[model samples]
Target: MQFRRTVIALLTLATFGTPATAEGEKAGAFDYYVLALSWSPNWCLREGDARGAPECAEGAARGWGLHGLWPQNERGWPSFCRTNARSPSRSDTAAETDIYGSSGLAWHQWKKHGTCSGLSSAAYYDLAREAYSAVTRPVVFRALDQDIRLPAGVVEEAFLKSNPDLDPDMITVTCKANQIQEVRICLTKDLIPRRCGTDVIRDCTADRALFTPLR
Candidate 1:
């Protein structure tokens, strides 16, 4: 009898908990979206320079570039979901190069995040473009003439000041290798500002992180 009771308890625990999303699960099963904006100058200074990436060319003058529009859940996110949607054509990916830095990134974003959106490649790209346009990236950062180190919170504050609609809870700044990495904002599927999930609201507490100036 004890053995049967233990088996039943285990079944109950497995059925009721919030599980991390499995790879290649059903599409469009997420709760919200995270729009990641990468600081291009910082990327150039970090990984891009090592790879001799064209985006890091001396005169590019890149700023905040669209990273990806990731689908998120209240607890755990989905990725590389199974979908019947066709992959994006080369031209479709190329159309996004102005904001995404390369056609390859756009294609990769579609395969990873866009597949889980339940939208066709065309619709997903359109939505991604629309979300990128809605956010107001701070202009003051562009005026930076030289590298500086500052608290990561200052970057978050500047974003809040520029975008009054975004509350502190809706956005976060992340750091990598003591350099400012990406600014992530949570939004509803319809592209309205929303509070991020607990897992998504991790703010970088670094007192000083390198900020590279644009070319």
Candidate 2:
């Protein structure tokens, strides 16, 4: 009876995978990072306006805002991993609102992807800010004075042209409901440009994705 119970326990562990730490997977165990930049105007049009997101206010003129810096694997990603890192305080999250558009997003990013980085909350936020500054967002997008519909590849091409170090494989443009959403760039743990994993390389093929001008 004891032998049968042990065998069953082993099988359960094998099937469910071992929990190395607390109630989640071990932290700091990822291959690379994905920097996500959201087009603020488009997002406002999609869902922010309804939610009354302050970043969507008229004349905000927000272009590409930091969405998150996500820890990713070669084929998958980690989230909400167990870590001993301290959570960001309200002030810590507030400091990132300029880049993230809201303290709520900053908080969420730290809770989800940031926890998986294994870095202390402060270090993770600092790295996220650093990564955002490293990318050269295309000035052309901000020059738009009106809403327009263009091929999604145009957005990708602009990014490639603006950041010579970024190759086609290192970045991807995502769209939703025929609207341009965000530009996701893959980088090394040290924040250098790198090819994205296959799972992160999915690009939008919309021939006429709506792009809204900065407010």
**Residues 132-201, model 1: lDDT tens digits:** 9999999999999999999999999999999999999999999999999999999999999999998789
Candidate 2 lDDT by residue in tens digits, 1-215: 99999999999976555322222568999899999999999999999999999999998989999999999888678889989998999999999999999999999999889999999999999999999998899999999999899998999999999999999999999999899999999999999999998778989999999999999
Positional deviation of residue 196's Cα in model 2 after best superposition, in angstroms: 0.6
Candidate 2 residue runs with Cα over 4 Å from true position: 1-23
The whole-model lDDT of each prediction reads: 0.93, 0.92
Prediction-by-prediction clash tally: 0, 0
Give the poorly placed runs of model 1, Cα more than 4 Å off: 1-21
Q: Scored by Cα lDDT, where does model 2 land?
A: 0.92
Residue 78's C-alpha lDDT in candidate 2? 84
Instruction: Estimate TM-scores for all models.
Output: 0.90, 0.89
Colliding residue pairs in candidate 2: none
- TM-score of candidate 2 versus the correct structure, residues matched by position: 0.89
Error of 2 at 210 (Å): 0.4
